[model samples]
Target: MPEHSDLGLLVLPEAVCLAEALCDLDWRRYVAMVELNFDLTQFYDHVAHRLGQPRMFARSIAWNRDGDPLRRWVMAHCGRHKQTRNQYWDRVRRHQLPLVHSGR
Candidate 1:
């Protein structure tokens, strides 16, 4: 099967599988795993090495068309530290508000 579509996006089964595995991780763990604070080139390098597809990734990046899906996938899954914290507080408000409920 073809690894990429005509738009140069990563359509490889292995790449999709990798994206799924990466996205399943907790946001914090994903950030740590990807070292997201670093430049995106490092991310590309890391993924390429992990997938054993350096040439494919490199060419995709060079063509300026590949990696968008992977980048979007990573962004969608990670970098939600604030959102996670807010969710925790929301849970606390919803389930641990006995004082408020008692009007105390």
Candidate 2:
């Protein structure tokens, strides 16, 4: 099987919640570490619900000569900063926060 990118693993609803929790624990200090952080349970719940809808996760091509809409949706609408996963995890490890249970 092809390996999935960290963003491929995390851009969905369930994983985004954990990202939010990390941010909340640090009071926005780690905002640069993640692309998006959502603290509101209601909003997150809405996202989870929407993702469950039929055809919601379907892949399609971008028209209208625009750039990557998926990136815009994930970064802009989701309020995430654009950073590589390595940079994110490195910062998290350097912080030495107790929230992470699996980091080296």
Instruction: Pick the TM-score winner.
Output: 1
Compose the digit string of candidate 1's lDDT tens values, residues 14-91: 767576546645533544444333434555555676677765674465346444776665555445554764575588
lDDT of each: 0.57, 0.43
The estimated TM-scores of all candidates read 0.37, 0.23
Show pairs that collide, candidate 2.
Answer: 35-80, 36-80
RMSD in Å for all candidates: 11.2, 18.7
Model 2 lDDT per residue over 10-56, tens place: 36674665455434534233434443334323333433444553322
Collision count for each candidate, in order: 0, 2
